[model samples]
Each structure stands twice: as structure tokens, then as C-alpha cells.
Target: MGTTQLETVPEPKYWHLRTVLSNALDSEFEVGEILPNERELAARFGVARATLRQALEQLELEGRLQRRRGVGTTVAPPRVGVEVNPTRHSWPGAPGDAWQTEGCAEDVPPAVVGRALGRGDEKVYTVHRVRTVHGQPVATELLYVPPASVPGLSGIAGLETDAGVARGRAVLRELQRLELGGQERTVELGSARAEDAKRLDRLPGAPVLVLTTRYLAAGGTAAVAVSTYRADTCRLTFGESAGTGLLAAG
Candidate 1:
């Protein structure tokens, strides 16, 4: 009789450490509880400091841990849920909007953004916006609008010179003048760009949730907005019922 031999699966050390730490987090650690220093943790787990760090990195990416430069690592609190529903069509600057205008610039967008806007080589108006909750910055947005789409913006004040927050507001106000037919939104995983990282107070190449929205009008694509939310701090919810968890947490 021939016996069948089972193949043994080999698991990476960091992966096994991650599992152990995850269990510890669930059964022992409380939210905001400071974790032991890396050296101690490495020694306790009998692994290299780099391996322990790898486990912590995975936990942080999953929103289970938080690390600050000066402050040590701690168990992260639950992520804040932000809603993005489409029951009604409204411009970004509409009443009760959570974003704040930061600045505006007229320049050729990056190739990816220009491709999405269906305009290559032509200049577009870029507006910078930031969103916060509990005074902590959670997301940074870049809204692109072609000149032909917002013809009346030329008459708006401060667009040519300062391009400050006032100009951003003026551009949005002019954008709302057009009739919005519909909009499309998509979410994907992405790395933080340098400028976006500075805005979100994170290191370059940090994990982020990228949301791309395209606003349509009778003419065609009127605007395109790309919002980068800190994946470690945000849990995006959709629909009216999305507010339930947020309200309870608050």
C-alpha cells in the first residue's frame, strides 16, 4: 500500500508574529494603550527588531495600531466613518459640506488626472481642499476643473493673482452654476504622494484610500476630484444609515 505524504506549509516569521500580536491586541490591549518599546517587544518575541516592526506595520495598516514620531506606538481607536452617498446631486461646496477650501492653482494636471478629465496638455484649475473631524486632518482632496467647463470663473475675483482660499471658494461657486446631471465615484488603494503626504501629515509612500469622483453636466465632464483619505484613520461609509456608527462613536 502506498502512503500519501502531506506537504508542510511554511509560514513567515513576521506573519506568525503578526498573528500573535493581533491576538494580544484583542484579548489584552485596550484602545490607546501604549505598546512596549520595540527592543523589548523584539526580545520578548525572540525575533529581530525588523521582524517585529514588520508585524507592527501590518497592524497599523489594518487600523489596529497608531504610531507617532515623538510618541510611541499605541492600540488605535476605531476609525471614523465618513459617508459618501448619491441619493441627491449636489456640488462640493454645497451647504453642510465637510471640506474646507485651501487654495487653487491653474496648471497642467498630472497625466493620470488629465486622462480622467479627458483633456491632455490643456491647463486646468486645481483646487486643494482638506477635511477634518475632531480637529485631526483625515483627508486631502485635489479637484480639477477645465477652463472651458467653468467659463464664468474668469470674472471671479482673486483667481488670477492670489489663488488663496478665497479663490477656491469662488471657483466652486462658479462651478455650481452649471447643471449637474450625475456623478461617478470610485475607491481604490494608493500610496501617498509627497504633496498629499505633507497635507495629511504622513510620510511619503504611506497607505491611503484614493477616491475619484467625476461630475458630469450637459456639456460633458465638468469636474474631477481625487480625495486621499488616511487608510489607518478613516472607514468610509456610504448611504443615509452610514451615520449610525459615527453618531454612536461621537
Candidate 2:
């Protein structure tokens, strides 16, 4: 590849470099290919290391690159397509569901979740789950089910023990008994919280897509789930055939 010095343009230097790098990624690099070191990249572009760093950071945020600890920087795989259409509704943990239950605990949820449940300050069963694609953790969820929703769940046991997994499974099983009237969902961009960041292997305050779902049954909200997905690895889709060719544009 030939070197191209950056021209003096009104746009920010880093922004211009980002475009140039993006084009090169399209024409030259394959997915998961390791990038040249910062010094080499800077010299090749005839820009300072600071400018090159800024450009690289921008690309990572846009999902064009990944900066893995100890592995160096490489082109990122295409974002996974996650279906978010409200019309396609099913209770979590259904046979075809992709999430794996991690644990369950009874706790007073955040104010936003409490409001969604319409049970202010009341304790609910919070089921923790992780969603992975190709063995890579991409999302984590906090599913809040009111005690009233899962009346059959018994045996108040330790939540951190092996029993916790059983408890989470029981809650999900009980939920399937109810008649699912419908569900409402909302998607928004948010910063990763400390807990969610750790699970997704991202730094706290990294960009994430927050998907909040309210499962309605018996004329009330049966459960509320707040799922945080790594924005760099996911693309929210709203169709029956979601996630197909999500990265085709790249």
C-alpha cells in the first residue's frame, strides 16, 4: 500500500483520518485482521501519534475496529443482529430463547423498573442472564418479575448458591403459565453501567444499547427486563428475519 499524507482540510484531522482508514479497511483489510502499530500507522499517514490515536478510537466506537487487551487492535466482526420487534413476543427462557440464566435474587429494583412494574419500593425477583454469540458475551439482562407474577416459586434459599440457577429457572417456568397478553419495548442508547460493562468486557461508560421490555399479562405488567447490549457488536433489528447480513453494508 502506498502512503498518503493528510492534506490541510477544514475538517478535524482525526475525522479525516478516520474516513481514510475506513476506506482502507474496506479495500485492504479483512475482518479480524490486526492493524499496524500506532507508530507505524502514524508514520504511514504522515500524522502525529496523537492524531492517529484519535482516528483509531473513532473507528472502534463505530464498530469498525476492536482494541482487545493483550491482543492489540484488529478489525471487528460484523455486528450481530438482535430482533427487537414488539409484534414478535414470547416469555423469556422459552425453548428458542438465546439467553442463559445466571442467577436470581429478591431486591428492590431501580426507580425506573419499579415504575414499570407499578409496584413502588416493593421487592421483586431479579433474574440475571447473559446472551452470547459465537462464545462472545454481547449482552446482559436484568429481568424483574414481581412475586405476585410467580406465585408458585417457593423455597426461599440462598441466591448465590447452585440453587440460584434453579430459582431463576422456576421463575421463568412459572411465567410461562400466565396468558401473555402482549409486550411493549423501547430501545435507546446508553452508557454501560459498572456491572453490565464487566459482563460485556467493556469499559464503564462505553456506548451500549439499552432495550427495556415490559411483559403484560392478566391486564398488568408481569415482568420488566432491562437488557444492555454492546453497541459495537450488535445491531437492533425489527423484522421477522433480523440479523441477516447486518454487516453487509460494511
Candidate 3:
């Protein structure tokens, strides 16, 4: 009788498939390229349809793929970045600003925003925008301000969209009058939440740069702005080489 031996076969892993596909995309695919339809790709890889989809979803979350409801998934374009610090070299909202205006939204912000407003949550103005650089969407900005802090807001016409650098200046021009106080800013490691991830076109857990700034004016806090920037694509710059630097660290 011939000796019989049983050989155990390892189960296939879908994550391995995703890695293979991701590498292929980075090495060979062009931005906006439509990937092979799921059915075709799954058959080619000898993987189940569900397994193939799992891989695709991860790619889409990483902003590597753009999936449409009906148009199919395409390769994602690059992301944009906007500098959030007030450096001597670059003001907050200056002409030739790296970020282009996306739009503004007025809403009651989160509880933290309410605390920043000091009204316990009554006053709020949220300016929503997508900051881009070199034609990529790298960050999303939500600027919140209490109405009392922005006393002359109505007079500061059109700053939200077409105001340009001068608009930021005009909005902040009053700072010089209200005792021109100091400010506190914090930078921290963070991940993009679902909403921010959607706007920034990255995964929910993607690394991000979170800059929280509290502006002080007229013996009180004027505004608090939280800017979420993509870590993979941006390097936040602060201070200038030549000018007199006037930033207070807190």
C-alpha cells in the first residue's frame, strides 16, 4: 500500500489582495483611471466578489480611488494644502494665498465652539472652505466666530468669497483697535473624522494636522478657528527668517 500524506492549504487573504492592487495602482495607473469592474477584477484575482469590494473600499477611503454611484471608481487626484499660521511671511488670509475660496457656512458649531464663543453656545459663524494647492484638495477649514467678537462684520463686505487678502485684513483690521491682544494656538496629531474625511477625500482615520487657534481681542477672546490639514501632503510654516517675529507660545 502506498503511504498517503495530507497537505494543508492556507486560506487566501483579501488584505493581501488589496495591497497588491494598491501597489499596482501607484506604480502603473494614472489619476482618474477607471479600475476594472469588480466582477472582472475579482475573476482575474481568483477572489470572491465580497473580498474584492473590501479591498476597493479601503482604497477609496485612502483617497486613492474615487467611487461614484453610477460612474464607477476612478483614480483619485492629489489633495490641496493651506497654511494656517499667522507668520510674518504669510498672513492668515492674504492675496496669493495658497488656498482658494470654497464658500462659507453659518451654523451653530459644536460645544467646544460654544465655549470658545463664551456665550455658552449662542453666537457662532462657521466659514466652510476647501483649501487647495497646486490643484489638489489637501485640507478643509471651518472658521467660527461669535457675532459680538465680529462687531463690524456686515461692514466687512464680501470677505467670505471674493474678499481676497484685503478682506481678511478688513475683517481683522479692528484688532488693532480692540487692544490688539495676544493669541494661543495648538497643533496636535489627529485623524480625519468622517465628515472631514469626505471633504478632504481621505480615509476617516487618515493622519491629519489639526491647528486650533484662539484669537484674543478687546480684553476677551475674539474667535476660535480650527483648521484640519492633511499630514501626508502639507508642511505647516511659521515665523519668518528676516522679519521681527511676534508670536506668543502658550
Candidate 4:
């Protein structure tokens, strides 16, 4: 019996390192599991620290690695899809299901929000949240709702947990009571704020996708939620499937 020697193939330093790390993560890591520090990992890979850091940065943008401050880098999970579907009106939860809520004093809203709400300097409920993916922060969302539009809401009842989805559910529970009429959405380029950048582990002023939508209920404007999702690591899915019409040209 004899053994045959196999040929070895190599690519760019960073590319090979990235592949090695990505495969290791897929096979050996669980969501929220932190990887060894850069210095250690680079030493293990026999590559320069800069090369390893570049690879890690790419993986992080791809939603595979999560970098934290003071803490360390960890494996990031897949991004959750929170759709803005016309078919569904509310989320899964009780009247009070959000992670937490604060009674924001009434104040004048931004110009864009005022137009969406179709009111002038009206008081509204402002809710903010930091959504995490794979235990790493990803995005920040702000929800502004006119108090009069959401009737019978004495307080934010179910928002206390650290879970962002729970908080969204709580808001939906309160929102469902009003008849959902129509809605509008817009997408624009935005720079990350200091707070959001801190959570997302990106430099301040990093590019992001800003989705501003107004929720209309009971033939009147209810609230507007401005959600900022990382453009590099996120995809927005909207509308129905695309199909060729019978009358269309091939």
C-alpha cells in the first residue's frame, strides 16, 4: 500500500486567512460565541495582524463576526427580517410586549415627521431601540406616534426586557386597535450617529440605510418609525415577486 501526495493551492494572504476563519466559524462556532483575540488568531494563522484584521472586518460586515468594545469579537448570527407587510397589521405579543418603554414628554416633532402625521407641532410617543444580531448590536430604530392617534394607551405596558423584538411586539399590540388604513415608505442615505455607531461597532458617520415609514390607521396617521439598518450587512425586501407578463416582450 502506498499514499499519494496531494498538490497544495494558495491565494492572496488575506483571502486565504478570511476563508480559513469563515470556515472555522461555520463549523466550530455558535451564535454569540467570541473568537480568540486578533493577536492570538493572527499568530495562529502565521499572518500579519493587519491582514487578520482586514479579514475580520469583511466578515463582520457580512454578519458573520460581531466586534464589541472592551469586550472581544464574537460570531454573529443572521439578521432577522422584520417586514413591513400590508397583509399583517400587528406583531405577536400582548398589549405590553416591548423590551421597555419610556414616557417621553410631548415636544415638537421634526418637519418630515409632522408632514407624515398631517399635524402641526403635535405631541407624540417616541420610542427608540437598539436591535442586536447574534448578540452584537446592528441597528437603531425610532418610533414616533401621535398620542391622540393611539387612543387608550395610558403607558408603555410591556416594554421592560432587553429584547428589541419584544418591544416591537408591544408597540404593535397597542397599534392594532386602530384600523390600519394605508402606509408609505422611503429610503435614503444617512450617516450613523455616535450612539448608533457605538452599538454597530462602526466609525461615526459610516453610511447606513435609513427607512422612514408612516403608519396610517383608522383613516388617520398613527405613527412613523425611522429604522436605520446597516447597508453593508443588510438587505431590504419589499413588494411581491417579479414575473413576466404574458403581453411583455421576451
Model 4's alpha-carbon lDDT is 0.63
Question: Which residue segments of model 4 deviate by more than 4 Å?
Answer: 1-11, 82-87, 91-103, 133-135, 151-174, 198-202, 239-250
- Model 4: per-residue lDDT, tens digit, 1-250? 1111112435667766677778788678787787888788877777689988988987876667767677788776655443444333442122423223322334568888888888778766566666654455556777777768655555666554323554444555677677667667777878998877766678889888887777777777788878787755555544441111111110
**Reference-based lDDT, each prediction:** 0.81, 0.85, 0.63, 0.63
Give the worst 10-residue stretch by lDDT in candidate 3: 241-250
lDDT of 3 by residue, 1-250 (tens): 1111112324445566767787788778877678888888877777689988988877665656776556788776653323344553322354454444454545677888778768685746565556764345667777676667667766665665543445444544443345436667778879999999988767798889898877777787777768888766555445552132211111
Evaluate residue 101 in candidate 2 and report its C-alpha lDDT on the 0 to 100 scale. Answer: 96
Worst ten-residue run, lDDT, model 4?
Answer: 241-250
Alpha-carbon RMSD, candidate 1:
7.5
111-177 per-residue lDDT for model 2 (tens digits): 9899989999998999999988646688999999998998876554543344377889888998998
Give lDDT for model 3: 0.63
TM-score per prediction, in order, is 0.72, 0.82, 0.57, 0.71
Model 1 residue 160 lDDT score: 83
Best model per TM-score: 2
Off by over 4 Å in 1: 1-59, 74-78, 82-85, 242-250
- Clash pairs for candidate 3: 79-136, 79-137, 80-136, 80-137, 80-138
